[model samples]
Target: MAFAVSILRLAISTAVFPIFLLHFLGLWDWICKKLFPHFMVQFSKSYNKEMAAKKQELFGNLHEFAGSSGKLALMEVGCGTGANFKFYPPGCRITCIDPNPNFEQFLIESIAESRHLQFERFVVASGEDMHQIADNSMDVVVCTLVLCSVQNQEKVIQEVHRVLRPGGAFYFLEHVAAEPSTWNFFWQQVLRPSWFLMFDGCDLTKESWKPLEKANFSKLKLQHLQAPLSWKIVRPHILGYAMK
Candidate 1:
């Protein structure tokens, strides 16, 4: 009787342990969804502001779109919490794309605050598959700090090329693989596995700019930017515009 009872108890514990872990993970994800957006929005404020100025200096052509008689169509992949809304010029319409549906309310609030811009729509779509948007429609495609987490970076760039009208530009800012034999590079590799797991699939050592070079854009330009020491591990970044 004692031996039978011990065997049964062990079997029950084995079965229940997996079930408990599964539920615990699901609950943790739920909590993260509810809280992570606010943290992302807050942490991005200063970085976004500084980058906007530098971006304008690098590609001042965007200013030409301002105050046009007709609205210039723009698509922003991974438009998290609409952090870039304030930086857009007047007489532009924006189409926001993000995989996380939880960001819709935050985006709506951001749109309301942008008096110069018009909100075309928000699609809960990943950058790799922007099928809902019509081809050759967007005048500009903005991708800032986003390529780090995309499942297929090349596919996303191809979609950007496809949706852009002739003379359109794809503007991107992304953290890239650090220089070899450096402390930052070493730390990036060491922390990548765990970091990717914690931070929505963001890989530390992805050479995000390589695919942009392969794409047959009419003009392609890239400039390297130094990240703050506080973010040293993922500090090296590339920013540029690719004209279609």
Candidate 2:
């Protein structure tokens, strides 16, 4: 019966909640990679050339940027597994930050292989707190599927604004809450509590579009870009950019 299944789900989530709390404290990503390296690897493997090509097309068009020749600096907050590595401009410097202990090593190793692009850094820092870097120090700030887990999304937006120069841009791809329907809403409410446990601090339903709009930035450009905007939806990601 539906009631029995709901009870079973609740019981499972109740058991997993504590561990999730620790994950929010930045523990689960490490454990998932350690306990299930292949799973994590498989996840990364699927993030293939096509996704990178799409990202390149979108961001490159948004910023009118294609490749790097001079000394330009790029940074990605919450850079998971460094999938954005390929998109890094040749002959440019890149920095990535993520709190996942399991990812830090892999990120460094993976990105360092790019002969044309230099790995400037990859630190374990919260996206909201990039105060250590000087203001207006970056040419571009990139974020992809990263907003869901951040505890203070507002602060992160502020930090992005702070870090970019006046003409600089913040390019992003984010999944968010969708329009309500009967069955989709029903299951999202039911499974989100349990499902969030497995994702690296992802939220099934997040209103992530507002922060960038409200931030102190000029020339905002957004696309309501989540595929399957209504049906069988999980990662209804909003992807776009804002000029700072």
Candidate 3:
């Protein structure tokens, strides 16, 4: 029995060693970044169509909140491939932020395609610590499909609030934990470890809306719904805006 156990351990170690080596060499993150943009294209098309009305309501009148420049100063944290750029109203001066610098090329392509938006710059920074952005500077903050992968959701929310001007709005769309006692939730739990490993730290079971709820926004409008054309594990989603 002991010999059998040792053999099983060896098999498992051998199977995992390549993954460990990729991570150690920083190639795993690079691979995920390269592939994720392509993978998200179809998902974004479906999600954007389904969520169009809500996004319109959230962003259509953003010019009303514009400062002296007649443009909304918008910042999107974890702005992978700028999937939400097409949703913003015209004349938005947009700054994009993401921890993975590898997404920069894709982001530039997205910016080029989003000609109506004025690209401010892309900052390679994490949402949890956006010290490069000044406090009370942004007119609007946006995050989509980001909270699940952030190392510290609460800290990210805090940073969002800190950077936004008083009365500035924070918009978000994120997949969250499915209801307890459901098959999807069970699978979410079972697959979470491998999902995290394969998808660049996305926790399949994160209750990402809790931190948003507790963030003490002046006004909050959140809706829980199922994401259309999404994987079963990521179907439970939240979409809304909070005013700072």
> Per-model C-alpha lDDT, please?
0.79, 0.72, 0.84
TM-score-better candidate, 1 vs 3? 3
* Clash count, one per candidate: 0, 1, 0
Query: Candidate 3 on 1-244: residue-level lDDT in tens?
Result: 4454456545654666776578879888778777777766666777788777767766666676677777899999999888789888888999999998877888888898999999999999999999999999999999988999999999999999999999899988888999987877766776665567677789988998788889979999898988764467788989888998
By TM-score, who's the top model here? 3
For model 2, how does the per-residue alpha-carbon lDDT over 22-67 read when each residue is reduced to its tens digit?
Answer: 7779887667656543455555556444355557766564325322
Q: What is the per-residue lDDT of model 1 for residues 112-213, given as tens digits with 9 covering 90 to 100? A: 989898898999999999999999888899988799999999999999999998888899878888997776776676666555545666898999888999
Runs of candidate 1 with Cα error greater than 4 angstroms are: 1-32, 49-52, 65-69
In candidate 1, where is summed lDDT lowest over 10 consecutive residues?
59-68
**Candidate 3: regions farther than 4 A off:** 1-27, 41-43, 49-54
Task: Using lDDT as the measure, name the better of candidate 2 and candidate 3.
Answer: 3
225 in model 3: Cα distance from truth in Å? 0.7
Cα RMSD for candidates in order: 8.9, 4.2, 4.7
Instruction: List candidate 2 stretches off by more than 4 Å.
Output: 1-40, 49-53, 62-69, 228-232
